[model samples]
Target: MIATSVEQLLNNLEGTVQVKADRVSVIDSRSLQLKVDSIVYNAVFAEGLVRDTARWLLWELGQQLGIYPSSIHEFYMAAGRGELPKSCTVPAINVRAMNFNTSRAVFRAANELSVGALIFEIARSEMGYTDQRPTEYVSSILGAAIKEGFRGPLFIQGDHFQVSAKGFAADPGAEVNAVKDLITESISAGFYNIDIDTSTLVDLSFDSLDDQQRNNYRVCADITRFVRQIEPEGITISLGGEIGEVGGHNSTVPELHAFMRGYNYKIGDLQG
Candidate 1:
């Protein structure tokens, strides 16, 4: 059942349709067939009634944070086209929560500030609802945005789409397929930015740096191709690659060169 506050909040927001919330054992959120700005989003609330005042606070906060939906490709294209104003800066806020307190803060701040051209993303490793799968990350963000009365640019990003070395070594096929599946689902969920992190596969023991980044670049290229193939028409997803593992060694120019060379060779031609 939908909470009274949440129900009331949705009633105030335009473009909400068939808003539904059911009490369950855990927490989560999803978008329904609701349409706004030619994009569809449905709002689903978690189990148990949430009477949190943040719902109202978020709604109020949205007035200041106008929606700034943009993809990673948009940023790059602007820079490439030299359309960016001199000394322009973009603030990316990390909304690490799905339905809890942290997300509430993000909604409040973004809405209150009326910030433009902001980015919202969560790394694959830091997600809270691990059981819900990665795609739900976007759904929850949409739900939160709807709760806050946001109706503009909402850029969902897949930060650190990664492969674990141990997992890969044990079952390369499964691990590779899993990453591919994530790209598919993330794109379907309207995630416009994907960071392919195969740094864990970097074979530092290899005598040649090029050899070390073979796995990293190859996998990144594979995923990039997959993303390119399935991406919605007229839009290019921002794709990023990591050359060095975090907490290990700092990345160097050689590693970057090796990765880009391999990636270009694998994907054939880079579009935009």
Candidate 2:
């Protein structure tokens, strides 16, 4: 953790800095703040390079307040139960690049500007790019929210918790354990929404439809069980699964049904 004061951190944002996209130099924090206050910041926030640094600064400031990350499951459950109003969508932001900038923008907009669940996510590969451990990602997001004085619920998600078939085939134990470790580490970091991507595990060599889906659904079910076992009571983390790899093949209704059947058999009744 950095020993600098929030004021110091915020001050650091000041002064001339180069933005690579257009080679436009931000004059200082006040100038950048005004830019952020504009709609153009939305576009700027989408840029990976600029967004990462902006969030790093805000996160450093936010950590001082000791804020904890919120769960996305509650929001989804509320929406499903018709508690949330129609036409409501929460912004689930990828924190790898734009964590700080977009976070402060959302918080400021919601509290000050009449704007914007503000979900922060870090995928498995993203952990490497940003060199952020799961705990670090959680802390940074909560910290950024705290700095903005945004008291709304904060959702930190583990996006694309996946397994590649080649890797799994090489060493099934290692591959499965990698996913499990991610689940454990992410939960420890307060991630409540996990996307289990075992789509690559599909075995097309099998003639039976159910056989083709066996690996994907079974693996998803096993991981889901693991998540359920550790999840806090009254808080079911929102879980998701895919039927197939994105570029590999189109998913059919039969495949979907087969997956659900296998998943249910392994994990038990969804309603129960």
Candidate 3:
């Protein structure tokens, strides 16, 4: 019966099918509405210690007057929720990197709980992270999803991915080729969508407006263009810009609205 339901759900989706971050993401408007870029530094990383990450998040929670993040990010539990996020467009959360066992566990939980897709971050423990190198880590994560008979969009986003200078200069086309190839590989291996990243932009600047826009939009275009060409099956691709400035987009609504144009998103509605 569950298998039949899964098939029906897959058959229903259209156009860049999205599975809400449902159980995977713990949404916090405080973090979401910040003006500067802090998630990268504040957000959990695949390499950073999980316990430490949780503790830091808890510490930050201490700072909050009333708001709190439920779980910083958990691989298995998030994966299992399989709930569609509550967004008309591009609303999702990532569970991030969990080992094969954990991922598998999450998949089951998601199905039982009725959730959408969970995001996975597969990479090394390098200070300067990049997906230029290959890994079985991704394959392991996807394998779990396939086993669960997942029928939703499984996104294996290329998070914080960049190629080394030597790798890039040696064979100028190598990195691009590798990423495209990886997208195919992930899809075949059971991933739904991809997020290609090729930027060095980490933090935001209130001073260099032009530089910030340049850095953010350029990467968004590059990522979107990469997906447009690959042509994956059952996967909708999107480029994430505006890695910073959610804190009301510079302490003011008007400035934030102006800044959103570069972020590749917008402030909708004409309501106060």
Candidate 4:
């Protein structure tokens, strides 16, 4: 049954989950799937406070059940350091619509294949049109995981947390702050991976590659610092930097070098 209120939700979850004064305990693991399915449905489709409560309960339940939101940064770092052999490409799936069903299908497939390195992401643009905020997005994914009995780290990401070139050009502080605000919201909502797409600010009009990527790297560095400062104590958010805009000219080695040189120099003393 779709829960219409927090009271009804707890009542519906009675046989499967036990709630006692802020503590949630699982009583019947076998029946959890259906109950969680209802919770997620309500989390996504219910109105206002009902939706909020469902999402909050789902998050708490996931944590109690050993399904934690995590970062893929260390995994990628290992691959980059050559400590890991190239085995597979981890897919970052964007659930643009029907987030609940799509994510549920993803968990089902991953369970069948024993895959644990996939990501469920939502871009900044997608968030606007899809009307799925970071909290709702995360809840849908976690709820799917719970329904599937998938116990592990959930890599939810804020994909393409991009800076708008026009907005940045018009008012730099406001645009930068906008992206930072989204980052803060996403992180708070259990998004441990973030792709900062500042490549839109890259100016090809400049003669040198460094000059071209100057604004991009400078803004990226500033945002990176903000992310570092606000991230959870133990979790290091996996951050991606873009050197070129999508559909733009192919990125050359010089462009990558330039972006990295500027980004690293600007990001000095900040641990990634």
Residue 221, candidate 3: C-alpha displacement in angstroms: 1.2
C-alpha root-mean-square deviation, each candidate: 8.2, 9.5, 17.8, 1.2
Best by lDDT: 4
The per-prediction tally of clashing pairs is 10, 4, 19, 0
Q: Please write out the lDDT profile of model 1 over residues 67-125, one tens digit for every residue.
A: 33347777767877889886766666666644333444566677798855666766667
Q: Write the per-residue lDDT of candidate 2 for residues 1-272, one digit (tens) a residue.
A: 23134333334444533434423343453343443332223212323533444444333333333344556766677899999889888776686865556566667777775544566777787887877677556644554455466654567788888887888999987998899899888887678788898988988889988999999998898889888888777778878888888786788999999999888888876521
- By summed lDDT, the worst window of 10 consecutive residues in model 2 runs over 37-46
Which regions of candidate 3 deviate over 4 angstroms?
1-98, 123-138, 146-153, 162-190, 196-199, 202-208, 233-235, 245-260, 263-272
Q: Which ten residues in a row have the lowest lDDT in candidate 3?
A: 35-44
- Residue lDDT tens for model 3, 177-235: 76566656544433334444443342345565545455444444554565555645433
Residue-by-residue lDDT tens digits, candidate 4, 78-120: 8899888687679989998988888889989999999978999
True-vs-predicted CA distance for residue 11, candidate 1, Å = 10
Query: Of the pair 2 and 3, which is ahead by TM-score?
Result: 2
Who wins the TM-score comparison? 4
Residue 131: error of model 1 in Å? 4.2
